[model samples]
Target chain A: GENVGLHLPTLSVQEGDNSIINCAYSNSASDYFIWYKQESGKGPQFIIDIRSNMDKRQGQRVTVLLNKTVKHLSLQIAATQPGDSAVYFCAEISDSSYKLIFGSGTRLLVRP
Target chain B: GAGVSQSPSNKVTEKGKDVELRCDPISGHTALYWYRQRLGQGLEFLIYFQGNSAPDKSGLPSDRFSAERTGESVSTLTIQRTQQEDSAVYLCASSRRPSGNSPLHFGNGTRLTVT
Candidate 1:
């Protein structure tokens, strides 16, 4: 079965450092990808997204890079902060369907 | 503007009991979705509603689970004869347009514990 998965279960980073989260997806048909952040006791919040045609997209202090050739996706956060600590998930969707398939999350722990 | 809202932030029910979870999407938003998250796991798509179109329920785990939406307003998810496996956090999200271009706004979600 096709699925999206993360490279690591947990990542510990010190404040003011750059943090990167990696994801691997098996479905070649997926055209849209998104990243979400879920804090404890809260629902996942939309972070950033990228289409298959584009390799990279940037938001406030965050960047999403897509490598379609390797079926890999990565999220980069600059100047990691305490507020950035959360569980991050990557989701993919194909044009033919409305379902957004999510990957197992990576827990980001920003140490002060 | 208010974001998506869900009722009964937490629920504890005994096995075999039925439960209904409610969701109120952002005003004027046309796309709504339901998802389930078990302990320490990513969300699992459950159902989707887009305007007058019939809902896409391909992700529903079983016949025991069902959902209903009125036009583009409130939606309810019903679980009948609930089992322990049904314990999870139910999240609701709304998008202003097709999620292909627009991002989804999610609610706090309802936490269900089946004993």
Candidate 2:
């Protein structure tokens, strides 16, 4: 089973603080990774992405870090805002496949 | 008009019935995908189409589930003899290509509730 999963089901953070979400994947052949944000009733929105060749990639207020050796992935959000409260998922794409394998997801709760 | 569009924002059907979900992808996009999301769950890959050619239907759950695309314009996912477990949101996404570099553009999705 090449499953991609997250370490925690939920995370709580204070406003203006940093939030880190962790994920682990079992497929070693995966070469591409992405982070998606999903609100209460909306589809997943692409946040950031990283390739196997690169260890890290940054977007507006988000960063995605990948460690191929440990099959680990993380999404870091800086200065968390109330609007950032949502479910975050890490999806990976195998070198041989076109479909993405998504993690269960981590629900982020921001407290003011 | 710029984003992917899915029809029947909400569907409520009885068990053993058949249902068809439609997806209208962004114009000129060659790649389209269908995914399922259960209540508070992760997205599950259903199927994907690269073009007018054959699609990758490996992610489909059972023999009762099938999908088809018409010349890269629209796609329909058909579920026969649907069960309660089939209740979920069916999402449609499209990308410029099937490559890794192209990010998927997702639609609002069709919420199907099988009672």
Off by over 4 Å in 2: A1-8
Per-prediction fnat: 0.46, 0.46
Lowest-sum lDDT 10-residue window in model 2 chain B? B50-59
Residue B91 error, candidate 1, Å: 0.7
lDDT of 1 by residue, A1-112 (tens): 1111233389999999999999998799999999999888888899999999999999999999999999999999999999998889999988777778888899999999
Candidate 1, which segments miss by more than 4 Å at Cα?
A: A1-8
| Global lDDT of each candidate | 0.89, 0.88
TM-score (0 to 1) of chain B for each candidate: 0.96, 0.96
DockQ scores of all models, one per candidate: 0.39, 0.38
Per-residue error (Å), model 2, residue A30: 1.0
Chain B TM-score of model 1, please? Answer: 0.96
- Candidate 2 lDDT (Cα, 0 to 1): 0.88
